[model samples]
Every structure is written in structure tokens, then in C-alpha cells.
Target: MSSRVQVVEQPGLAPAGLDPDAAYAALAARDRRFDGRIWFGVTSTGVYCRPVCPAQTPKAQNVRFFAAPAAAVSAGFRACRRCRPDSAPGSRHWDHRGDLVGRALRLIADGAIDDGGVAGLARTLHVSERHLHRSLVAEVGAGPLQLAVSRRAQTAKLLVEQTDLSLAEIAFASGFSSVRQFNDVMRREFGIAPSGLRRTPSERIPSADPALVLRLRLRPPYDADALGAFLAARTVAGLEEHVPGRRWTHRRVVPLPTRAAVTEVTVHGDHVVVRSGADVRDTAALVRRVRRWLDLDADPATVDAALGLDPALAPLVGAHPGLRVPTTVDPWETVVRAVVGQQVSVAAAGTLLARLVAAHGTEVAGESGLRAFPRPAAIAALDPAAITGMPGSRARTLVALAAAVADGSVALGSPDLDEVEAALLAIPGAGPWTTGYVRLRALADPDAFPASDLGLRHAAGALGLPEAARALGAHVSAWSPWRSYAAQHLWTSLAPAPVKEPS
Candidate 1:
């Protein structure tokens, strides 16, 4: 983003040149690489915008730069009436960060910071509040509260733009303490009043189909065809469907304060439209989970460039740069899906997973009539024979898997992939492939190499196991923490030809 858009705030802010000419050069070129990290504020127009903004670039002398939307607004620049910086892709740090900061961002995205205070967050992260603040500030150029306040303000802005929600409701739902607080934060972050952000509510998008409609983004070269085919084949009969046009629909039960809900996701180009069939009581949290599940937060250029160098993967990377490693919001759902797929054809596995959900899951309170995926506790307590119907080894495996997850033995979203594998391996029926799948998909581990996976091996054929393993390891090491995404792309190449989209 032109050396971070040449951060030229107050004079003597720093030694960095932050040359206006360089920043203007980047803005005029309309670079997508600067999508989120840096933003441009045109002094003449009294507006700030994303680097990829389609509007005409302002004069270089009339331009300024800010580290964040909040910073820009705090400087008296209003959001660009045209580009709407509030809705731009989130901060880069949010997508790539790990450790206390990453976890804290995830929690904040999920409304933890809103619902729970700093102490609550500290307790959940199992660290002192002081430590949490120190770590966040060190890593993200902002502390947890700054990050969260930004998030809450963004949520409030979105609710204003999209929904018929009252400002006060938006206040609470967006995690503000009061309407006054919401307004203040919005003004501080957006440089616009709450009333200023609103647009007339149009006729609602028809939800005739089973689709959860919302906007979604990924880095370039997204193989919509590849993703569509994969999702279509594996969708559950009753709960999920991937239409021919690359539109995907999957039912998920949304949890709310008053009750839970059944929501569907309709993912199309550039946006994943969510059809709640219920109030978007807390649109922020729902949006956060959708981003996670779709792996929308990944930076593909960084990942593809790293993993694409391998001779074996170079071709696959060439074809599918936008390939994403599918993830789930709930680890229990992920483990169960993995278990259901065991020894079964992909289609059969999807059907069984749906069946298991139907048999055990509670009906969601909202409109779509879908049910929640069974929780770990629910599955753990179920009769193994009733669950499997085939009463043999698979049943035993399912039971063990459920028990382990139910008791926290299998840490699905664990930072420790090895720990997850160890926990899953402890279960009788969980094989190396299943454990690896869980690690790769559920835990989001980049290095979770499933060498035993037939698909991976076949995809790696001619390279030979030792050689494949060595090459893959070396190639993916460059991919580092994002290797899971690389593995997903490789696996996609190996998946049966009549590919379907994710469930």
C-alpha cells in the first residue's frame, strides 16, 4: 500500500518519509494490494477512502493518510460518501495474527468484547488484563479496546446501512453500552452521525431459495467453479445446497439471547448474503462466524506465492489461486462431519451427517426451519447404536469421538495441531486421515500434513511419498502458518472430478 500510504500525520510523527507523491501514485494506480492495510484521505474533498476506491484521485497536496478508519475520522475527515470505508475488508492484522492477539480479535469479532469487558476477555484468554493490553498494543498498533471499539463502531455503521434496526438496538447489538456511546464511537470512527449513515430500507431480497445472502471477499483468481462443484456434491439434502450458478445455501442455527435460530448462507461473487429468516439481532457476530467458515479472511497472494513454488503444486496453484481451506464455526459440527465421512462416500457422509443433525439437533427458532448442529454434550450423551444405525466399529468410533469432544479431550480449534491429533488418535475409530482432516480443516493449522490421506497421496503421486513429503514440507514451509490453505488447494485438485461446493 505504498509503504503504508506514507503515513504523514502530524509533522515529526515519525521519521518515515510518507511522501505524498508516492501515496498519490498508489492511489492513482488503484492498487488492490493496499485494500485494507492503508487508507487515503483527500484533504480537499474532506473525505477518506480505500486505495481501491473507484472515485477519482484527489490532488496530492490535498491528500492525507491515516493508520485506521478511526484515526481518519478523529482527524475530521468524513467517510467518503461514495466508497464507504466502513465496509471495506477488515485490518490485515485481524486475518494473519495468532497468539493472544489473534484469539482476542476472534473473540472481539464474535462479540465477546462487546458482551464481556476487558476483564472478561482477559479471563477467557487466561491472562491478566494488563498482559492482554500489552500484547495487543505490541502486535496490532492498537490495544484490545481500540480494536474492539473499532469493530463495534463498524457493526453499528453496518446495521445503520443495511437494517431497519433502531439506533438504540444497534447500539446494544453492536456492543455499545448506550446509544450515546454508540453515537460517539461512530462519530469518532466514521466521522458521520448515526443518522448520516442510514439509507432507505429497500424491499428485502427474496429468500425463496435456501440461501444465506451476504457479501464475501477473497483474494483474486477465485475458482468459483471449483468451489461450486465441491459444495454441490457434498451438501446435505435437507440443510444445504449448492446451486449450479455458483450460489451456495447452507443452513445454520444462529444462537441469540432470547433464543436460537435457523439461518441460511447464499454465497455468490464478492458477497455471501445471509438469510437469517430471523432478526439480524446481532449481525456482527453472525458476520464474524461466516467470515471464519468461508475462510474469507485469508490473504491468498501471501499464501499462493509461498506454496506455488513447489514443482508439484505450481500447476495447481496456477489454476486456483483463490482456493480456500473450508472451515466451520463450531468445532463439534466439524468433528461430527469428519466422523460421518469415515469409510463412507462423500455423498453418503453428507447424508449421514444431516441425518445425525436431524435426529439429535434442536429446531432453530427462526424462519428457515433448519436445526442446530448437535452440540458436543448432545452427541456425547447419545446412544451410539441409535446414532450409527449400523452398530459396528463406526458406532464405537462415533461414540469415542463424541466423548472426547464432549469432554474437551479433542481440542478442535486448538492452536496445537499436534495436541488435536493426539486427542483424536486416542479415539478408537479416528484414523490418521480423519485426525489430519480435523487438524487441517477444524483447527486451521497450516502445517497439518495428512500424508496418509489417499487424495493427498494420489495428488502427490509420481513425486513419491518420501520425496512428496520432503517437497511438500519444504514447499509448504514457505507457506508457513497458512499451509492448511495450501493443503486444501492440493486436496481440491485431487477431489473427484464431479466436484461440489462446501456444506
Candidate 2:
């Protein structure tokens, strides 16, 4: 193998621009910013670790840096026991790119591989299995299966450390098919059996109930207040709930592959506590969706540094250092929400969506009082004339979108943003704003900006920039690649000031 790192010249997967020397420097300094962006394997000990791993740093000559954790494992290295590199927040480098590698990574993280296997994943990406395997190996130093294996190991380790799920439960929950396979993979990845990886009693969270409680890590300075407020303001009555305060709690019905489960998230300091009763088969998928929903994988320091360069946005960036564009767990829900929200105020949109959910959504079991957002098939069955409280045109648009989604003509799971956008635009009533908003929240496209939005236009005009969509788009071009964060900053400026309570 060459001493130099090999990358496939992709846009966002350049290891965050770190060469071997720079990667070593970051590793030696235990830099938190580079924690997820790069991993270095120790040639001597044959273990890989995050840059922020607290163990003794290996000699520079003994280190080989990789852009992904799967690469290290593929290169014959176990995870560092002390550092638990598998627990590192996901790299934001891959979050925004619409490329093949980026999309593949996203799907793999979402348990596409576990659900359907490598052949299935290739089919979804519309590539030959051979081509997909080769591309992934060249770009990220691992094939799709290897990447999925690494992900499963990570999930299993997390369950071992955090939840009190039985070993068999953890195995299946992490996407392993058999206990033997799970044990072998765990030993190979971590140099220990699954049981050996469990945390001490004092360190573990007490699992007194059936709910799987896990603490998801966030790259700080996370603005929990800002994220909570954004979700709370637009919460649908039967589908979501938010209890607002200094430390807020948000709950929503998440539709998993096997079934729909209600998931609860509470903000605790640097991390959020996630409580879910999802099936063991769906636990890994639920965790990945929760991470996306919370925007926990973002590199706040890098985003803030980039946006802070603009004088107009500098103040907003400074005020809300880690303000995230809160995304959705279900892309269909986002599409429906975006379409229904058109030409209507946020409050009105929520009321209308609530009506739809109550009428068509699947109610959760027991008395949680939550209902999963109506799936496309459910909504597609309704006649446009039956959708109350919305204009006929908008109602027709919603049904049309539902039919498209139900038919797989508009694949929300597709990695190709342009293709998805084109298909969405083909719907009769879906316009630029609807497509743009879907791209931003549903697809988690960081550069996605609904420039036509009145709120965004007003926010830009207040900042002394152009108010027209075309002009504002031009002005905000400098915020490229990070425009989603820039948009959040702008919209946040228009929010009413919070009342101060007596100290």
C-alpha cells in the first residue's frame, strides 16, 4: 500500500482536506473538530482510533489515515477499546454531497444494506453490483458490505455500552443475523467479545423499562433552544409534541421499516436522550433516523467558520453558533408538509396537517395518543375533494404527490438530488419552493435554499440584502455548500425575541 492517502477525487470526501501529515498533527493534538472527519490506524498495534482518542498517540510513521472508519477495519485494524472510535459523531463531509459515494453512505447508514443486502443496495442506487462495490472501495477504502459491517459493529457497541438489551437483542438490533456472526464481528472489530464491551453497572444507564434509552452525541456548541423552538412552532397535533423550557423534550412518531414507533428525544447538555420502543430489528434504523432528525452529525466549528466570513451573516453565526436545519425522519412526511404548507401560514399549515393525520394516519398502539404521519398510500387513497380546510388546488397537489411517492416515481430514498428534484417538479402543483424545501429538510441537502420563501426573502431584506428571490439567491451564493446553515441563520433572525424570565 502507498504511504499517501488514496481518494477518488470526490467533492466532499477529501478527508476534510487533511493529508497524512496534517492528519497526524490533528491526531497528536487530539483535535475534536477532526474527530469524525478522519481516522488513523496504528500499524504497530493494529487498532484504529478517532483523532480525539485519548490514548497515547502513535508515532507519525506508524500511522495510516483513512477518511472512513470502515477503511481502517478493512485494512486489518481493530477499534481502540479506550477511545471507542465507533461512537464518534458522523462526518459532516459526506452529509451534503449528492454524489454516488455520498448517497451510498447515507443509505448504508440508514440500514439499507442490512435490510436488503449489497445486491439490494445496488439496485436502489441503480448501479451494477460490481460497479457499486468497485466505486465504494476506490473512494472510501471499503465495499458496501464492509461499510455496513462497520456500522453494525458500531451500533452493537453502543447498545452494549448504553442500553441493557440482551445480547441476542443487541445482535439483531445492530443488524447482525446471528449471535455467532455478531460475536465474531464484535471480536474482529473491537478485540473483545460483546459481553466484554459492556460498561460497568455504575456507568450504564438503568434500563428499568422496555424503552431503549440511548444518548446520541452532538457536535457542540449545539443550540438546543433554537432547534427545539423550530420543531415546537410547527408541530402537528396528532403526529408530534414538544414541551418547551430551558431543557425541552420533543416526541414524534417515526415510521421504521418493519413498523411505526413513537420516539422521544430530550435535550440534556451536549447530547440528547432518545427513548424509543422500536422493534429490535428496527433499532439501528431508528437511531440513524434520530441522528438525522437532530442534525447531530454536523461539524459546527467548520460550518460556523465558513459562514462567519460574511459580514452580514457573521453576527447571526456568532449568535447561534450551532443552529441546525432540523430535518425529518420521513422524507414523505416532509414532502407532504412542504406541499401543504405552500401559500399558507405555519400555524394554518399545522392545523391542516393535523386534520389530515387525524383522518388518515395510523394510530399508535396503547394510549400514547400519537399517530404516525399518514403514509403516501394512505393519502393517495383519498379523493382530492375530501381533503378539508385546504384549497382544492393544494389538495389535488397533495394527492398527486402521494400518488407519485406511492408509485416510486419520486423516490425519496434516492441519493440523486437532481433526479429527485426533477421528478418532484414533474408533479402538477409542486413548484420551486416546495421542491427546494423538500431538498433542504427531507433530503438534508446542506446547500438547499428555498429562495422563493417569503420568510427567507424578508429575512434577507432585513439584513440589507436583496429581497427578490433571484437577487437573494445571487447574494447568498457566497455561502455555497453551507447555505442551508446560512438560511437557518437568516430565518432565525426573524423569529420574535424570547421573553426573559425573572432570575
Scored by TM-score, the top model is: 2
Identify the leading candidate in terms of lDDT: 2
Expressed as tens digits, the lDDT of each residue in 164-199 for candidate 1 is 667888888777778888888777666668998787
Per-model TM values vs. the true structure: 0.81, 0.94
Per-residue alpha-carbon lDDT of candidate 2 for residues 180-297, written as tens digits (9 for 90 to 100): 9999998878878899988887886666678878888887889887887798899999998987777778888999988888888987777889888787677688888898888998
- In model 2, pairs of residues that clash are none
TM value for model 2: 0.94
